[model samples]
Target: MPIVEELIKEGRIERPGIGVTIVEVTDEMIETYGFPKGVAIYQIMPNGAADKAGLLPRDIIVAVGEKRVETIDELKEEINKYKVGDIVKFTVWRDEKEFVVPIKLQQLGG
Candidate 1:
């Protein structure tokens, strides 16, 4: 894949990331919290991309661009499709409403 090629050429692969700890929203969680299926932001690193973009804990990420992601892996996969510093629009669900947040991805720490 492109990641392998990049690593081979550059000796390292810089992955795009929004600094946040996330948890997958299971069916049980959705039923208990009355939330839709998605990955919930459990924590945000201070001054990181997510924090800078005003993303907060408990925000549910429902989509990356036009791709709907219902699990942590899907979110990660979607995020990896972009380069660091690329501004990607994420569909977030918060307080029972859905909105888009533009986040500039930063390089993830090794």
Candidate 2:
């Protein structure tokens, strides 16, 4: 199959990833989490970009660079703008405060 051949050739999917399991912050969750708008990170991959950048579970990503993100799709759009090994600054909301973290992108499934 083409999928098998591609896997053999590339070894991995060749997509960039931040190694996070995120969910879109709903209007109700905004009140519950006390964040204006963002994607909620629930799980972090061990030793991955988020982990390396010290992003913890329950942290809400409000922006990528200067672009405000309100959903998982927006976050994906922002992340797709960068390539692997590029450091991207993420605006995070936690404990009713905002902070920035720089994370290096990594190849997904590698």
Candidate 3:
């Protein structure tokens, strides 16, 4: 199993939908992407919940539910507050635009 999967099974991480790989948004990244502090979507998995929700790679996630997340760890921590089948709202920054999207969570191994 992948390390992420193992972590999920061990309850050390939340089971996010196979939607995106995220990285901490640094000042350099902000200058490059023209976004403020947040978690950048490094990659978006095909046919995943985020994909289905129209989230694209390079989109910066600034908030989950009602909490702002500036780091990848904060994003993961916010995600961990919910379980599979829960729908969460995400505030994203893309192409100088900010929008909110709803994504339904899924089991890691599902």
Candidate 4:
């Protein structure tokens, strides 16, 4: 397992889904990834934000609100558009179908 994954398992990173600030990995690292041609790779965190929002672990997040997210930086920037306690919507591709999920935002970095 990756060091970050181990940290998460050891309760070292802030886990917003669990309402813990000391999460093992940031949202950008946990939910987003980089790819050539700007395509993004995604990972589902079991019961994390994306998972709780109905996004599959293998789903690709293409957009957040109106911003196109093709990279982890893009995803973080898009998410920053909203503040804590806000409800944000994301667009993802699952099973070749585009879907939207609206979930409340949470605080990060303690």
User: Which candidate should be chosen as best, given lDDT against the real structure?
Assistant: 1
- How does candidate 4 score on lDDT? 0.54
TM-score of every prediction relative to native: 0.93, 0.84, 0.81, 0.57
**Clash count, predicted structure 3:** 0
Q: Which stretches of candidate 4 lie over 4 Å from their true place?
A: 1-42
Over 4-94, each residue of candidate 2 has an lDDT whose tens digit, in order, gives 7858997854566789999888888877656678898999999999999999999999999899999888899898877788889999998
Question: Quick one: ranking by TM-score, best first?
Answer: 1, 2, 3, 4
After superposing candidate 2 on the true structure, give the runs of residues whose Cα lies further than 4 Å from its correct spot. Answer: 1-13
Ranking by lDDT: 1, 2, 3, 4
lDDT (Cα atoms) of all candidates against the true structure: 0.93, 0.86, 0.83, 0.54
For model 2 the local lDDT of residue 52 reads: 90
lDDT of 1 by residue, 1-110 (tens): 58689889999989999999899998998889998999999999999999999999999999999999998899999998899999999999999999999999999962
Clashing pairs in 4: 13-22, 13-23, 13-24, 14-21, 14-22, 14-23
Candidate 3 residue pairs in backbone clash: none
Which residue pairs clash in candidate 1? none
For candidate 4, report its TM-score.
0.57
lDDT of 2 at 6: 52
